[model samples]
Target chain A: MIKKVVASVQEAVQDIFDGSTIMVGGFGGSGLPEALICALRDHGARNLTIVANNVGGVQYGVGILIANRQVRKVICSFPIGRRQAKLQDTFWEQYRAGALEVELVPQGTLAERIRAGGAGIAAFYTPTGAGTGAAQAREVRSFGGRECLLELALKADFALVKAHKADRMGNLVYRKAMRNFNIMMATAANVTIAEVYEVVEAGTLGAELITTPGIYVDRVVEVKVERRWQG
Target chain B: MQATESVADSRLTERQIAWKVARVLEEGWYVNLGIGIPLHIVNYIPDDREVILHSENGILGMGTRPPVGEEDPDLVNAGKEPVTLRPGGCFFSQADSFAMVRGGHIDVAVMGALQVSERGDLANWMIPGHELGNIGGAMDLAAGARQVWVAMEHCTKDGKPKILKHCTYPLTAPDCVKMIFTDIAVIQITDAAPLLLETAPGWNPQDVQKLTEPKLLFTKPVKVMDLTGAPANK
Candidate 1:
């Protein structure tokens, strides 16, 4: 059995290299792996491709990386700031200058693509982008008399996630609707790192309550109080 | 406008009610049709009118349903069911899609209804016994739309009345429904009360009252129209 628990998020993501693709799990403001992200910023890794639901809110969460210019490209479903007009100007300026590479994915397809990556599927066809700009560069196949666009699988070099609780062996429990993308992306990366609010002894977490099993997790970090952005 | 006559007009069948409701749709309206019974509205949209459909999953300018054997697994609506897009359609992130909804870009939102109260309060997302999934973007759509409409059967499958004095299920939007299109009648919900506008063919206002749990307010006499030959189901 692999030992997964660590003392801090900094230790969990210690080996991530520059230019690596990383998956950060969260939905809107909930269930974000903040400790791991803060550690990534502290490491100052650059030219990274990030896959996430949102780029976090302004002044906190994923915005920290954006503020530091550590992220080169972002693949996300939404990019909203907590305070409107705060980051819009900066984002627009960077986007217009082509300084930042951004690719927006449909929420459902994004979730499925990550899930497919974990499941070892190369690509899947769907009708979501049959006649839109989103279908550019993708192969279109007609299935069952309907046109479907092919979407490739998305995998990351590292996966960072936040869970409500976990055992020393890394079995995770998510709080309510916060489970979102963490469960699927946990298995879609080469190194899966998890930050938990509470860590218990191995076998303490019931099998039925574990949303993500220990088999997929490589490192576990325990975090104290979660910091919030006042803005 | 008498109570007895008004109640008589409110008890039509689902198909019959859908056809009558279709006439109110204007051309070139940006509309978001919710899952379930509201989806049936697509079958009744007028061919002459260009209705741009927006899905919360990030597709705008959607077309009629695709043909069999051509279903695309990736091409789905907000409900995660397969869908087809119209010419000149665009796809974006769920964030942008919601920006369209929350920014007041959508003109109308037609949703399925489990319970509609006399006060026009709507409770459609969850019931007491069902397991609730993500609210997705329904709450935002319902709260942000310029107008909210509901389409549902007159009564539940178990013969329980859905039109109530007040909704008991978890609410998707509070007092957001402007008009309710039911198998029995088309009731326009105003700030004051729900007024009976039209009734199903053959069903009297009395028949409607018997099936409805709430006391419906009638402002004027209602007429029943032929709702057959609405748009073909896609």
Candidate 2:
């Protein structure tokens, strides 16, 4: 049997080094790998780059890493809402001070970049950021009357994803919108570690239900952490 | 440009502005309402129209908030607040959701703005000097939607106009806004020019132009946005 199970979340992420780029999957707290994130924070890897929808709030989800000052960069959509208007006051303190770098991508562009990395596409043009500051750099081309900018693919060294269920062989299934960025992140990373609620035998997860194939997953760690609900 | 509000009542609250935005929604349109003022639109939508609401976080056909005790922890809009999904509504990945947005499947996107130029430049994502900024999916929606509409206050709380000759902030998208629904007026953008189409109840075209820096063209007679359910004329 090709073994993919890891003894613990720590062991699963044991190889991550400082400055390693990580793609964490989730929208807000739902479907986040809480155990893996907490483990990463405990693992004490500094200067990490996080790619997600956002870091989430202070008391929940990836905010722990942000609050701990472990993150060096974030490539995200909205890092904070309008309520965090006092920007220098929150996790953004480092960003404003230039200690942390933020490469903000439009949500669609971010998703497509990750998907492109997994699919082996080197670059593509998108109209999302055209004619705006987001389109400031690189190449701009006109396609059928609409101008678009070329966006490159993005890949990560490790991807932490959450799943509702998984099989020992690593086939995975996600629940609801929580699967937000997990499916692509799983394939876009060199080492995809899945934190799942339940694990079954290799064939237990029906072929129809599996959203991600095990071949893309390098490790499977079963976790008992319930999905975080921001609401 | 197609339709202007016929109602003459002005003291348009956030809810009232939403009621006017709702009037523009045609039945069977798949709409995405941005946070802030745009969210109020769900409350005033006419009951007869069947509109499906889409959220960037991967929900479609999402309804208004469930009653207090009925909120579902896992069910929420992209904004992270509890929302109710109508029957036949489904959830997907954020990638898939943005594909729908970027792929041009969404019909309308109603959002707020910090600055909108006469040329339809949108600058909602950031204000200069802000510590943190996130553009999110608004750019995608602005670029990909069949039509993009802006609902915003006519002026800032400090009495500065939001509609200007040129946007002073970072742009979200260029030449994308089709219609602007403001508290004091409804202005249509035609060939990068603002057409003063309607005035609110108590305000006139002069009241709107005084605060608005851009040269306003009084194209076509002005009317008022319908505010049927608005708080009884303030």
Candidate 3:
């Protein structure tokens, strides 16, 4: 029987070298592989690139890594928190200080880019941000009289995804809105490490219920962490 | 815009403006609400309309904010605020979510605007002084939604016009706004010009035109805004 289950979160991320591009899965507070992130912070890898939807709150998942001076850059949709929370967020402070670099992508474009990366599509034109500042320094072509900006695919060295359940063979299923970026990030990375709540025997998870086929997942580790409300 | 007590009496409150926008929703329509005043629209949706709310974070059929103590971290709207899921609600990946939006499946996208050009150009995602504001999903919604409506204050604080002949801020999308609901007036954007549809009870076309930078066209009969269920006039 083939098993992709790893022994521990630390061991799963131990081989990640410095300057690795990692796709951290979470939109705000949900679906974050906190254990793996903590392990990555402890692993002390330097000059990392993180792609996420939001810059996590101060001293939180991605924030902790930024606080540790481990992250070199962040590519995300919304980098700062709400108006009141911006002053306290580490990414905002570091960004204001020019200590970190960022590439802001419109949320939908970011998602499509990851999907394109996984599907082996080189690049595609999207109507989003066609006339905005996001179109600056980018190629734009008119289709049916509507201009579209060309966006390139994005792939990472590793992906840390949180899942509700996984099989020994690494087939994964996600829950609720937490599935946001995890599904595409799972396939868009060279090494996809899934932090699941439960790992069942192969063939135990119904084939129809599995959203991510085992072929895309390279490693699985069970990390039991309760959902903590972000608010 | 922060209105003084006298001005507030004549203008629609945030809730009232949201209620007016809610009146525009059609039954069975798929609607996406941008952050801010647009998010409040879900609370005022018509009882007869069953509008399916879409959050770019991958939820469709989104309900209002969860009751206290029932908040689930995993169930959040695009704003990252905990929201409940209505019956028949479903979740998908962000890619699939954007496909629903970019594919023209969404019927209406209600957004908040910093400035709107007379030609219906939108500039809400970023401010000129702020170092490149967050784009989030505004661009996709502005570009792909079948119809775009803006819900915002008519003018800036200290009485500066927000509706202009041309947007000075960065554009979110060009010529996308179909309708605009402001505290003082309801306007519809046409190919030729913006037509004044209705005005608040205490205000008239001339008063609204004074606060607006662009030229306004009046309908044959500009109706008084229907502020149903709004607080009784002082």
Candidate 4:
């Protein structure tokens, strides 16, 4: 009957292996697949390469992964957060100890690269970091008198994303600004696992409202998490 | 005007400088406010004008902070601080949100700068020797927005000029800034040079010039900043 639902978070992340490139979706604390991340943490896949907006605050999503020493490298816009520095966060400590590798891209370029990866395009030129340090050691081209930097597409072994709702066939819908990187990451991964608030019948989700079509998603798991910000 | 007594004394408070920048925003404009001083600009936007706020994470028409306990972790601004959405607000994916920026749909991008060049260069995201700092959306906003306005203190806390002949820090974007609002003066970057547009009360062109590294140009007479507690439209 085209059921993609997984029984447990552990089962959803069981296939992940060491040295996998994982895209963990969230901007700040929003849209984080917390239970899935915790499951991955317990599953203990080592030397992971993570791509996301931030490393997450010290005790939060990606931070826990980094704290557990599961991540070897990160490609993100903001790896070292200002507030996290005050508390001597996990990323800062590992980064200072030269244990972690970072590839920082401009935020827009990061988003576009993931988008390109999903669409099967090789690479694109963007003016986001054209004349700055980000453009250093990269090819630059001019179009209509504006210089642009060439940014390559990024694909991951798996994408862990959070969504508001999902169907048995794995069609996904996101809520608010929480939609951030989840939509793009879902498309750019070899296997996309979505942790959603609810999983409904295949015909229940409106066709027009589906942000990620069932074709891209491989598994769906319902995970109800207490909102972390309220405390 | 003495150096020690005058420059520090005449400098506007951070809130006052934000109010001055907020007063200048046009109606029906889409503005992106960077973290720190630029975030304060929202509190002082004129009541008569309806300026749409853009948060880079994935929201347009960003509104004020939600009251305690009503906060939604799902909704946040570029700074990762929880925020509420305005009536006409909408959300999109990260790619679509940045498209609004890089597509030139954003009108003004207000940012805080560590250093600025007379030719409208900006350097804010990273330090010279530091291996990593948060780039975030600063570069895209600087290059993509129609106008880039910088809000910052005129000098460093140690009494060094931030407006420089050449920026020592790494450039965020070249030739992007259009105007600068500082504690002591409002400098407008023109095709020719940076011009002295306005100064704080009790300060003059010469006094402001002393603290600034680059030579100030006088294309026209400078006026005292209006800070009578009335909104700009009124």
For all candidates in order, the CA lDDT equals: 0.72, 0.84, 0.88, 0.88
The sequence of per-residue lDDT tens digits that candidate 2 reaches over residues A1-231 is: 788888899999999999999999887666778889989988999999999888676555667788778889989987776553433365656876777888888999999999999999999999998998766686999999999999999999999999888887888987666678898999999999999988888777889888899989999999875443434
Interface Cα RMSD in Å, per prediction? 15.3, 1.9, 1.1, 1.1
User: Model 4 misses residue A95 by how many Å?
Assistant: 2.4
Model 2 vs. true fold: TM: 0.91
Worst-scoring 10-residue span by lDDT in model 3 chain A: A81-90
Q: TM-score, chain A, per candidate?
A: 0.92, 0.94, 0.94, 0.95
Note the residue pairs that clash in candidate 2: B8-B201, B9-B201, B10-B201
User: Could you give candidate 4's per-residue lDDT for residues A98-214 as a string of tens digits?
Assistant: 788898888988999999999999999888877887777899999999999988999999999999999999999988887999999999999999999889888888999998999
Q: Write the per-residue lDDT of candidate 3 for residues B48-150, one digit (tens) a residue.
A: 7789999998999999898888899899887778898989999999999899889999999999999999999999988787874788999989999999999
Error of 2 at A11 (Å): 2.9
Q: lDDT by residue for model 2 over B53-139, one digit each (tens)?
A: 898888898888888777655667767777788877888878888889888899999999999999888889988987557788889
Query: Which whole-number lDDT from 0 to 100 does residue A165 have in model 4?
Result: 93
- Encode model 3's per-residue lDDT on A1-231: one tens digit a residue: 788999999999999999999999888777888889999988999899999987776456677788788888989888776643633556666778887898989899999999999999999999999888878879999999889999999999999999989998899998888799999999999999999988988878899999999899999999877676758
Docking class of 2: medium
By DockQ, highest first, what's the ranking? 3, 4, 2, 1
Q: What is the DockQ score, from 0 to 1, of model 4?
A: 0.81
TM-score, structure 1 vs. true: 0.54
The single-chain TM-score for chain B of candidate 1 is 0.86
**For every candidate, what share of the true interface contacts is present?**
0.00, 0.73, 0.86, 0.87
**Residue-wise lDDT of candidate 1 within A50-134, one digit each (tens)?**
9987775445567677767777888875554335356666665666677668776655567768888988999887554444344
